[model samples]
Target chain A: MSEKIKILYVDDEPDNLVGFKASLRLDYQVLTAINTQQALSCLNNHQDIKVVFCDQRMPNVTGVEFFEEIRISHPLPVRILITAYTDVESIINAINKGNIFRYVKKPWLESEIIAAIDEANKFYIANSMLFIKNEELQRAYNELNKFAYSVSHDIRAPLSGILGAINFAREIDDVEEMKEMMYLMEKSLKKLDTYIISMHDYYSLQRGELKIADVDFNKLMDELKAIYTVLSKTNNVEFNVTINQNEVFRSDEVPIRLIFNNLLSNAFKYLDKTRDNRSVDVTVEVQKGIATLHVKDTGVGILGSHIGEIFNLFYRANSQEAGSGFGLYNVKSALLKLNGQIEVNSVMHQGTTFKVTIPSI
Target chain B: MKLAFIVIDDSELDCFVSRKIIEHVDKSLNVKTYQNAELAIEIIKDNPIDNSEGLTIILLDLHMPIMNGFQFVEEFEKLPIQKQKKYMIVVLSSTRNANDISRILSYNGVESMLEKPLTLEKLTSLVHRVQQGLN
Candidate 1:
């Protein structure tokens, strides 16, 4: 069995203190404090005390003042105030000052007092766990920062070489020759930029300050559609968008945009080369407080085996395809922040479809 | 005779820049550029390379509008082996993953994978290797 939690009960009257110890000692390690001085002494001695139940009224000093004085030095124990009905105003003030977790009226039932102690114990344990987790996260953040710095340096070295080559080609007045070198340089630079952006986005999502708000689905869809319109025209691809419902869905707009933009951009970029009639379809539907957005493209689709890893960071299905491969990774991270899910289906040469579902705010 | 090369990519800037790089390395080399892979593949299929003359190299871009580089490879494989042998395929992409690199290598006819906005050193090396292999 686990060691029992320690609790301290402080009162001016010896009888009340004895009554509390006799009842609570069966379930917990109870310590009795007959006055303010004795309570402070017990707190100083008992490092494992999880909670303190202090009487609001005492001869020399109030419970609030005593708890406040010791708050900085001994912070682990949760403090609860005990008071009669007449002392309600002072107890409320104590709560405001952060000295009291809760106040129990005088002549309290044994079950009520026990319940308060149990609740305080749970709070103490939860806070301790949170502190441990926060420390672990800080360590991870430091390691990631170091890695990002090294990766940036590695990427920049290659880019500088490529840039130098491009500049040299241009300086020679070799018009035809400079064109090819410029292309290669651009490719290297894009790869570097993609890597840096992906690392930054991944860390930001992990930090979990997701700003959620009500977003107009229709407006967002229209804006995205307009951006892709030019690309669709140049490629001779027909893009269609259908909104099943006009109702607004509440979610983090930024992540939602990130998910849809990546999926839609991929659809346009990888359209089927053999087919003369190329088309991409986007549909939005809201049902039962769930918003589902579907994006389908008539393109050379992903192989069944490769579909599972599409969301993985730095994973590109085909090396020949020009992409950072971070797009889908960002989409996945953003979806997680919004409490959303994505599903993909594709046939080898037919097309690919992605369905994204998000909880409506 | 010097080899004639063609670049297929969606970015006009990429095509222009890659053409310049290849030309810088080998001035006598004949190069053509296409903004889309489908158009480039169609031209390649229509104008079969003459094996008696010299080899033709196709600098293929993987991400394109109609037919991407991978789809072109799948279709290009269906061509007669004799016609395929007259041409060598090189993939130009921005992707940098081991799996993606291996997938390109898996193609039966691809000569090499070059990370894109094609650089002088990489292009020079590729041309040198091809010339050495032919000799």
Candidate 2:
């Protein structure tokens, strides 16, 4: 009781207050308040006052009125009212309307007072626990809603196109026409496949635990370059990577890879095809336990109005391009998990730049 | 002279389907395909659509590179009123989302909204409407 739980008792009579503290002092670290103002001061000074006891009859205000007033300022402390025969009605009213946790008659025995304190303490714990759990549950429900909304809209839209094509293809028997329909079916299936992959990446980032490791910037840059080289050659894309690292940086590599993956894919997807000098440049520097990665692309840039919402799931600034719209959103969450940050600078029709900074733990 | 029909969509397959459906409905309708909305807007803004010729209709896809369907519609709406009267606009989409439908339908120039694959049944009615004109 001295280490944790503290109890406060308010009474007008000095002898009764002293007697009450003397009885329960060993069981509870008890404090006596001669009036409502003194009880409020005790509550303000001591955060551990879990249960409060007040005499029903006082000079200025009744116990019910005191409980009702303190209910606003010190709502966490469970209030218990003490009354005599004449104030039984007042005690009942306090229990009903003043948020009183329990009540005991005046000249009560030690066992009865102890029982009231124990019950009020239980009520206090349960009340606080319920408040904390409700907040957590509300957050979980919001995340589930985002996942459900993305799943329905992104997956169903592609499925409808595939179904419509299959239904239309069955009626046509011409070889050339059938060949064309087969191509359409193939495109729809590929789109579905890409969407499923991004969905997997999304849920994995959301549910999977992070495992930190020392990342090799040189190897990572080489891998990225090798994978995109074929595209660079075929599409006339000018791709470059420059890395400067002097220190060992530690962080989860999956999210870093995903961040690069999404940014690189966007670089290729949104490139201005007509421009002769289309390029995507990646620059990385690691120093003082901080790694900075920048991806710059000479692509069809995003408009200023759409820059804010680009990371939102299923949001498309240029909806014509086939994108799962999960890439940037996945990148955002993954960066958050790694305690990293990302920024975007874009000017419509000119180009776009993405900057990311990550700290090693 | 054959009446011109402009089909603006990012997907080549969708353009092919739309053109095929138009051919089945009325071979006389001259169909043109643009992969980007900017080019289509340029053609409209340049007034090369030839109003004195027969009826002109635009089958616009809601999603496209450079400029999206709504942005293109906003630009097209800025064109001279006489040119707007010469052409009928209809939006084609794979989305059955009520917001997209209601929003697109709210535009005065848009004649109707059609779902994907551009079925012959939908094309027949569109062809009929083109032949009937605004009269």
Candidate 3:
């Protein structure tokens, strides 16, 4: 223990308290008390005290009584009772009641006291670790329950729509109507395909270890432009990219790619059809050890009330267009993995802008 | 007086299919579609059909942004007793969640819960059941 483990000792006799602190002060941070009242105050002041030792025969209150009182107040610190050979029966009762961890003899041997302190510290560490693990497991279980519902809803909704379209097409003889049905079917299939791809991104980002390397924003932006150019042309929305970087930025490329891909897709997907001039702009700046990126789009912006909940899993703000609702959630998760932050600014029918910052690994 | 049908679902494709199948089953029927639950509720609150005209069959979707199907039913029940009698609500959803199914069924305004992709047979049977007072 580089830093001493704190231990508290309480006894009625002033000589006993001094002797205990003198013997163990070098190895442990010993806080001694002359009475149960002093011991309670010490516990309140130093919440991190790992082991509490009390003399069984004390003025006003006994060791067992103090242990029982503190059992509810300061439950974490392991309690030990110091008693004589004559008080064996009471010590055994205290141990059975789970009030104390163990007992030290009246004339304590230094070795026995050291052994008790070591064991108590180990128990404290193990208990805290178990508490943390249980919390993590509970969070994972809750997420899995949500995943189950989202999977069935997201996948089934589109599939059932496609099936219904097919059924309707079978009865109609009009060529133009048949083509319309085919278009609807294609749209549903595309939504399903997008959902499946993002689901893949979700799993990989969750399980995969971060592979950090130098992130060249220029190359990344070029690749994104190559993929989204055709889509931008078809929708008649201008796509612009600019990068200003003089420093070497390092991070996990996969998550950075996932984050930008989702953001850009959303930028293109929600443009206002009534607007004649629509544009999506991207700008990246790296300075010192941080990279700041912005994706601004001229689209039908999100409602003000929906700003806070957009990142929630399976939450959709706009029902007019078919969306998997996993895009922003995936982006948030990936940013969390990389210790990054994202912020959004938008106004209805005006536009939206997303800003992100990442620190070099 | 002829019966009328109203479909309130967020999905445009689902609404299209439902309207087509509903019209094909009986060309004489009148169908209205709403992509938002709030707009549908507003229409009902503003101009509830008269009981002497005909019964209105409302096919409501369970999942929608802002106001969901459950909230819509609650709002519908808040209307006057005579106005409520002019329409019958049937829940339409793609969700197989047991709790959602049971909870929506518990609403007094909801007649029955039907799965997604409304077919000609389902519509025909529903109309027959309503006509004979067997629902």
Per-residue accuracy of model 2 over B1-135 as CA lDDT, tens digit each: 346689997776667667766765677778999878988889778875464656678998875545878888888889888788777888887766677789988988788888765777777887776667544
Q: Chain A only: TM-score of every candidate?
A: 0.59, 0.75, 0.89
Candidate 3 ranges beyond 4 A from true positions: A10-19, A31-47, A58-62, A65-75, A93-99, B48-51
lDDT of 2 by residue, A170-276 (tens): 55678899797678768867877888999899889989999989998998878888888888888898999999998898988888898998999899888897788
Top-scoring candidate (DockQ):
3
Candidate 2's docking class is acceptable
lDDT of candidate 3 over A152-185, digit per residue (tens)? 8878987888887887777788898778777877
Model 3 Cα interface RMS deviation (Å): 1.5
Clashes of 1: 19
lDDT by residue (tens digit), candidate 1, B13-122: 56666676777787889899887676777877888557475888888876553466788899889888878877889998765556657987799888888876577778
Candidate 2 clash pair list: none
**lDDT value, residue A68 of candidate 3:** 95
lDDT of 2: 0.82
Tens digits of per-residue lDDT for model 1 on A1-361? 2898899999999999888888878888999988878888898899889999888788888887778877777888999888887766777887898877887888899888888987898899998899789999898888676555445443643454465465556546756555666666677677667667766776677776777677788888889988999989999999999887656567788778778878887898788889998999999898777998999999889988888888875566753435655779889888887888999999988999999999986
lDDT of 3 by residue, B1-135 (tens): 467899998777888888888888889888999988889989989994564768889999987876789999999999988888888999988999999999999999999988887777788898888888932
DockQ of 3: 0.64
